[model samples]
Target: MDTDLEILLTNDDGIDSPGFRALHDALSEVANVVAVAPADDQSAVGRTMSNEVSVEDHELGFAIGGTPVDCIVAGLEALGPAPDLVVSGCNTGANLGAYVLGRSGTVSAAVEAAFCGVPAIAVSLHIPEEEWPREPAVEEYAEACRATRHLVELAPVRGVFEHADYLNVNAPIAGEEPAPMRVTRPSTVYEMAATQDGDSITLRDLTWETLGAGEVDDPEGTDRRAIADGEVSVSPLTAPHTTEHHEALDRLADEY
Candidate 1:
């Protein structure tokens, strides 16, 4: 409790979400935590950012009326003491795979923190579709929080951030025993489709459907597969898209 390591806590599910509170209280055991999270749910908003947002003081920390990215930027620059780390989630649903990386607000908050030079961990709990109809007990989030606390306390000191900008972590809802842990990579599987019906097109992400059926095509050593196997999946990642010098692109540019 006397440690100087400060943590900025947030979630795409918003400030009042049970998952958020569970993680916040858990992380508080490891570091000083500030909750600069959205006042309302901002799920699947990705890295959508706002130039300005309203902030209010809450019992846990500052609540902001904006996107997850907004909360990260605001927290790092204006809301609290500059954090040693940023932890987003204990999200109600999992955020997995390469295609999903750009569309999950929980992961985007971690991405934003990475760009701002703070190490981060984005967390989610994998609750099956049938179970999602009911809100999970706050205690169920303990499994994810347990794993997160370990990473928060150790990753920095271990020089993990030298290679990874942030970590995307997903875990299954707790059962009688703690779930196993796996270091994984994002799944390469992509399964989005759109169907046109009369006046409008309905878009669907089939990956979640595959997950619900426990039949995803994700291979071994992948985030999706680890979560599917009821293990905590931790994937260390870089943010803001890696740029490489490409002679082919240079030639195409010269032609242009």
Candidate 2:
């Protein structure tokens, strides 16, 4: 048995979600997985932390009344022993592109864990809005779960966590087996447009609708492009605000 392997599972889609359930069951096969996820969908909530949170016992695991980040924090500090890794997602929708990272609660949970010095992975599936069912799509999500399981099995041996704090993975819908996994960077180009209607302003994300039109100037070999080409994208990401030497700042400080 892999006694050394332990994983903390979480998601933005809530505890009752089939996506979370599928991932938890799959992860349990290889690693000791403990799920502590939101009680309700908290997608796009980002890294927001609440002062007070409520937790309830559920059939799958503990349902948390907070953002995705809270679930990871609770899992690590309150649920059980410190896990060897944190895995967030199998999210209902894809969390791709550079701009989406700051807005995706699923990916943010992994980012939060990375900040705590724990290796993490955020897995999401790309689905066209038109194809999305009225209800949650468990079967499609399960396909992504299979990929997640494979990554979990190979993560340790591949040394994926060596240089990266966390990995952001977005897999296209399964057809044959899977196209191929590509190491990529998040695309900077986005299609976030806002419309002002009276006093209320509505923000509409047009990435999906416009991406097919070749309307975006996003470079190739990016997360978006990888998924666009029906390949899995594995973007190794670092924690918030990576530090770099600033000559101008240093000079200013010296003068002061």
Candidate 3:
């Protein structure tokens, strides 16, 4: 077994963001870490990959002028030696629920790594609405750094990535004792709201505001409920879109 591990760390937040830097510094304690993140914030950009990416050098590592997916692909294909693990985020905010898993550029980096058959972890901090000070702050990301460190140190075990193609971690703010770590699935509940102006449509992100109010039907073990209850939520996710047998499609194929 390779005692020394190499880790590729990236985030949707720009390379200069505190969250990304904190995570990079913390993970360096565990293994050799490489940072390949966007030059600017790419949050909620999803798995979209830019055809053209410009790379620049940073103190931490390389900052690519592209999406999270671009960073991961460039890191794997051309950045450096292939990493033993890929870690995304220490994001500014939590990445929870089914709606977010598909849309979060932070998690999308991990998903992009999983597609390359590399084990990956995506970590984020859950900043409660009440926790925000009168002034906007990004200090809560330290909690996420702590969680990422713990997971990285302990990930040398069997089956750590066996069932979960990639791990999605959402940690509550700092000063909390180890909340019960629950293995969960992404919640289906979504708070997508949109409005129309005279000529343009206006959309709003209501997920952060309505963190306390959740759906009644949300199951016992889901990323949403686990986070709402102030626990560290760990959801195991698989890469690749699922393919299922379709009788109707099969009939159409036969007609062809």
Candidate 4:
């Protein structure tokens, strides 16, 4: 394990969330953990940075009245020294599948950190749909936090960032014992639905319902599948939007 490593921690669920505090406590055991996070929930806002934000001192660390991306910028540029690693979340809900990468504030914070040239990890917990409308206790995040701490302790020495810019980690709710961890890829399943009523339309995502039933058709080696199998899912990913060489575009440009 790396000794005396400085870690910058932030989350989309706000600085006061139980999941956030759980992660803070877990990481503090291994490194110098500084918490600079939103003053209130900023879920699903994705990489939205503010030109200015209000900052206040808190028991854990600093709190910013802005999005998760704002917290990362504030932490890196003014609040603290450049961190050896930036960790976002232990979020309230799972950030699974390829489609969710850009829509998740937790993952977006890690994305911003990666663009700033720091390795990052975004962690979230999968809660069953039946558990909604109930507050999750701090103990409920133990497994997720433990898995995250494990990666924080080992990923640096293993050169995980050499091949990947950031990691997206999701774990099932805490069980009697710590869950096993697995390397995985984002699942490709998309489950959006819409309904029109009179002059109104409602948009819904049915994936959560599927996940609750453990009936998603996600194959092996996918984040969703791993979580369904009662294991921690870690998806190593890069930050940049990649594009392959295109002969058609090249021909169009040449003709012009």
Candidate 5:
């Protein structure tokens, strides 16, 4: 463990959430962990930022009345010393697949950190919808907390950031035994549908229903597939968009 390493801990779940506390406790054991997170739930808000956000003092650290991205910026710039790494989540639900990466506030916090030139990791747990209303026991997040801590210990020293800007991690609810971890890629499968009523329409994400039935059909080496197999999935990702020269565009430019 790098005692000198400082970690900025934030989450889409509010600062008071058990998931956030679980991660804070787990990481505090290995590094200097500072919690700068939303005062209330900000899940699925992505990288949305407010020009000015309200900040308040909290037991763990500071709470921002804004999105996860706001917490990252505040933590890095004002709440505390610049962190060696930024870790987000132990999120209430798994942020799986390529489609959700941009929609998850937990992952977005890490993305914001990556753009700041710091390595980051976003962690989430795949809890069945039925399990969400109840307060999850700390023991329930054991596997995810452990996986997150292990990654925090290894990523910086192992030069993981040399190739990837950030990592997205998901774990199933902990069982009696620890789950195995797998390096994975984001599943590209996209499925969504909508239904109409008399005066309204309902948007539905069918992936969860498919996932719950053990029918995802995602191949090996994908995050969704690894999670379905009860393994911790870690997807190394880069933040910036890549571009290539286009001959077709050049020909059009010449014609113009």
Candidate 6:
């Protein structure tokens, strides 16, 4: 346990949510972990930030009445001391694939941290459909958090953050036997769908259904496939947008 090592913790789920509390308690065992999560649920809100936010001191840390990104900026800049690493989630659902990277608040929190020049890890649990509509117990988060704590312990010294802006990790909900860990990349497949009704346009993330059915031909080393195969998926990712050389754009500019 590196008591000297500090961690800034935040989540899309409210600070009091079982998953957030569970992870906070679990990581506290490994380092000086502080919670600066939202005061209310902010699931799927992406990297939205509030112009101003309310902050209240809580037993674990501060509960920010704002988005996960707001919590990160507030925590790192004003809440307390700068932390060695920033960790987001232990989210209730798997945040897999490239389609969800920008949409998941848990993942977005990590993205915000990377933009703020901090290495981050976004963690989530893949709760099976059988367990839907019920809260997962704190104990249930144990195995998933084992993967998280291990990464927290080694990632800094291992030079993982040197190359990667952040890591996106999703662990299967705990089973009698802990699942194995796998290195993966975000699957590039996009399958979002929407149905039009007279007054309502229903949007569904078809990817979830595909994953639940184990019917997705998710390729060999992608995050979704690892979760479907009962393994913890760890994806090292760079934060900034990349641009490739484009001859078409060059010709267009020349014509102009």
Where does candidate 3 have its weakest 10-residue lDDT segment? Answer: 132-141
The whole-model lDDT of each prediction reads 0.92, 0.84, 0.83, 0.93, 0.93, 0.91
> Which regions of candidate 6 are displaced past 4 Å?
none
The sequence of per-residue lDDT tens digits that candidate 2 reaches over residues 43-155 is 89999999789999887668899999999888888887688889998887788888888889999999999988899999987876676544455666655777788888888
TM-score of each: 0.96, 0.91, 0.89, 0.96, 0.96, 0.97
Q: Which ten residues in a row have the lowest lDDT in candidate 1?
A: 126-135
**Model 3: residue 85 alpha-carbon error in angstroms:** 0.4
Write down the TM-score for model 6: 0.97
Residue 6 deviation, candidate 6, in Å?
0.4
Q: What's the lDDT for candidate 5?
A: 0.93
Which ranges in model 2 have alpha carbons more than 4 Å from their true place? 1-4, 132-136, 212-217, 251-256
Point out the higher-scoring one by lDDT: 2 or 4. 4
Residue 2 displacement (Å), model 4: 11
Pairs with backbone N, CA or C atoms under 3 Å apart (clashes), candidate 1: none
Error of 2 at 122 (Å): 0.4
Error of 3 at 18 (Å): 0.9
Regions more than 4 Å wrong, model 3: 1-3, 130-139, 205-208, 214-217
| Residue 145, candidate 6: alpha-carbon lDDT | 89
TM-score of 4: 0.96
Clash count, one per candidate: 0, 0, 0, 0, 0, 0
Model 4 stretches astray by more than 4 angstroms: 1-3
C-alpha lDDT (0 to 100) for residue 172 of candidate 4: 86
Candidate 1, overall lDDT?
0.92
TM-score of 1: 0.96
